[model samples]
Target: MNPLIQGLATIILGVGGCIGYFYASNLLLDKVLYPAKGPNIASNIRRANIIRPWLFIFPALLVLTVYLAYPVVGSAYRSLFNRSGDEFIALGNYVALLESPEFRRSFLNNALWAIFVPVMSVTAGLIAAQLSDTLKWGNIAKSLIFMPMAISFVGASLIWKFVYAVDSDIGLINAVLAGLFGAGPIDVIQIPFWNNFFLMFILVWIQTGFAMVILSAALRGIPEETIEAAILDGANPFQIFFRIKMPQIFSTIVVVWTTITVASLKIFDIVYAMTGGNFGTEILPSYMMSFMFRDDGRATSVALVIMIIVLPVMISNIRQAQKELR
Candidate 1:
């Protein structure tokens, strides 16, 4: 009954059971239920072809329903109930959330993040992608620029936290500023409103790499002849990029924008690790966590709000993907 052993055993059993069930079920369907050697061999083969894809897809559909669909519904339901879940409060939680100053601040900060992070990240990424391509050691430059994408949000926050640390000696930014200006250390995170941008800079740094890699690929995929024609027509580098190249890569830019928009809405770790959602840096996810145990209905309401905010971006991304597929 050791917890570690029990967990390992459960994992093994779960994986083994799924493999066994799928293999056995497929075997049963082919061998016992519809033997290909029998008189109706052609019919059996056709039926198997029709059912095989569904067999593979069914497990994924079930997992999506269980993991994704369930939680959304559960959150919605919880938001309608009281803290103890014994009493129904209807739209009271949402009304309270909209009315709460803290929630309003979180909402505004989140909105600012959604706007600032994506735009700045995409802009920085596009510039890096375009510039790196023209370099002789472009691949090396791209690799260096893309490096931060490998770091987790919390890890990046820790790294930037040192840069923003109150101590002038240890923190890189304050130390340099102090040395230059002969001033004391600055507690950047304690500064209201502006501190949110400081946290946003971390995300922009991390996501710029993502945007760069994607946009870089999109940039490279552009036809060389088009750029050659642009140059032949007396187009400068800026003209070639803005007028000729950018139009082609616009879709990818939108993709990167919406993708990062969704991410900024769900940002938690950086703010949590850096400021613990204090000093005007609180966002929706962090606010939800703060209220989770103290007030279940309000916590769920905040979660639902976050979901609502991200849902449209998700839908747009999905639609764009499908359009591209078509």
Candidate 2:
């Protein structure tokens, strides 16, 4: 059979099966569980009662267990075994990961990213949001500032790659530096700790727009009467921002911070595209991918490491969501 035809057949069958199952289930429920009375029914015949809403939730719970919960448990099991999936290696992979200098470096780089990217991105976004809020052409300023978010991470990295290209005439950064300092073109990605900073700048650039959009909406949500009251009480602009507006949107600030933190934790595309995790710029995700082909155990260990690193922020975000629900 043709591969395309087989693929189409599979999709059609899957859709038909789902539709048929839903239709049959509804028919069965209506006929057997919730049947209507007819004119010939006995007067003393008891009607069936509907089950509680929680009983109706069982199918969704089962689906989640099969799709989400099972996979997580299976991955955790796989992380314990070696590449062959036969021999149990216990914590050997994790131990090697911790003891290896390269892994350590990746951990430190990821740690730096987690710390700096969120803080800098949210800070820049907050400042931009505040400034744009007070400006007459706020929408125009916001549209320009938020334009970078429209670019994918890979595209942004490619764009910045040009900015950091080695040629003094072509790369904007080197061009500006060469004109000023009369120095030769330098490779930005090869510059040790500074390269991490360069890679982080891309994330900050992309995420600042995200932070701005969220924080700006939060800023606009602040009541006008509160700001006027603060002004009447002799509060200056700084005081109004810090004392009045900041308090009102503190939860939103936390949400933006955690959101950016989670994104920075899983950041792989920018670093991968820009440097391929070279020159001491390897974060956890990129470093993990390097081990994938050579050693599956080590790669899975690194995957678990990323999961551990991200778990806290995920929990915090969940808690924030719960609080918001209340």
Best-matching candidate per lDDT: 1
Model 2 lDDT per residue over 170-230, tens place: 8999998899998888998898799999999999999998899899999999999999998
TM-scores for the candidates: 0.94, 0.87
Write down the worst ten-residue block by lDDT for model 1: 312-321
Query: Model 2 Cα RMSD, Å?
Result: 3.6
What lDDT is obtained when candidate 2 is compared to the true structure? 0.86
Residue 302 alpha-carbon offset, candidate 1, angstroms? 1.0
Clashes of each: 0, 0
Alpha-carbon deviation at 173 in model 2, angstroms: 0.2
lDDT accuracy of residue 223 in candidate 1? 97
The global C-alpha lDDT for each of the candidates, from Candidate 1 onward, is 0.91, 0.86
Candidate 2: misplaced stretches above 4 Å?
Answer: 1-21, 38-67, 323-326
- Give the residue spans of candidate 1 off by over 4 A: 1-14, 324-326
